[model samples]
Target: MKLLMFIKELTMLIKSLRGLCLCLESGSGDKLSNCTKQHIQKLLKANMMGPYGSEWAVEEKVKRREMVAPQARYIFVYWNANEMMDNAFTPLLGFLHFRFTLEEEIPVLYLYELQLDSSVQGKGLGKFLMQLVELIAQENRMGAVVLTVQKSNSLAMKFYISKLRYVVSSISPSRVDPLVGVEKNYEILCKTFDHEAKAILEVYSVQYRTARRVGFMAAFSDLKFED
Candidate 1:
């Protein structure tokens, strides 16, 4: 979808959030300033470096430039001056970077990053942002809200699953084939809105289960007979 169309569909979404202490503004990646991009990088590094571990260096390079891609859409969050204790200026609190695209042939709002400053962690701001993303996906007729979470980030995994009700997508590597999935460090998570999306994204197909069973049996057969 074109950027203009994407903005037109959800312009009111951000406007409706004015009552929130944390103001939200929509912007395309192409329009972000170098300063703003640097801010995003810093926030991401703070939140992700630990979870990413040795892979962080490589992933950081990808995210640093990916945030400014023309097709990327962002919801920039800012704290109101009154909410700040030290400074009178409103500071950037966080951002949600996403794209409208197809996943497994289904149109989806794929969230690439949801990074928040350390000060705002655990406050429900993250959940609020996710809710907004879901609303935007629905408003645009997208099938689901999809995101990737590192398996090492247990807190993030729990937040998305326990708090938000996101499921391990059937297309997720682990769900598709546990044997092979053991090598993967991340999982694709999703919240589906309709039956079609639920079936395609959330339901574990028979084939996947069969693969798991076959792999388990094969492993058993290879074990030395001790009896």
Candidate 2:
């Protein structure tokens, strides 16, 4: 049953990519050769510099090597809106860098990065990439999909929370200790695929679960209800 769902997800991703005029090439482990690594680094650097600044990505040159690590997986999305002419190339649209890892001892997919060009932003490409990420997570039997977002990046927050239905992870540093940790200016968010993952990662605190519950309660504190 799971196998069937997995196959279906793969098929769905393929169809969706074609429909979007994009191509998906996924590779695992050492398949990410030096040339591939260079390509990814270049794309990431270009996409990240605007949001994070040049100083922040100085480390990315070194960190990008993780994509080639054992068990790591890379999904590169390419733009095929224009056909290659006389050996010309189609540009890269975006990519997903993720890997299987243990979260609370349960298998999960940790999304290192999901990047799309500015030209494609808000055109449903980001959501399409995330859909493939979720499908890949489920197909791999992962319990959840996890990623980090900068607090200053409200656009990303809204995209993940309101659009993708992800929530701030209970295990996030800020959630665990909001005082000092909040100064970190980032959040760890996740979307679980199973009950166990939900239990582990989802925040069930009254304040977090409810929509502005504390504010509502305070505003209506003087109201009395007749039983």
Candidate 2, residue 50: the lDDT equals 60
Give the RMSD in angstroms, all C-alphas superposed, for model 2: 10.9
- CA lDDT of 29 in candidate 2? 57
For model 1, name the residue pairs that clash: none
lDDT of each: 0.86, 0.77
Q: What is the lDDT of residue 57 in candidate 1?
A: 100
lDDT at 166 for candidate 2?
Answer: 95
* Candidate 1: tens digits of C-alpha lDDT, residues 137-159: 98788999999999999999999
What's the lDDT for residue 160 in model 1? 96
For residues 72-99, write the lDDT of model 2, one tens digit per residue: 7778877664644444443666778888
Would you give me the overall lDDT of model 2?
0.77
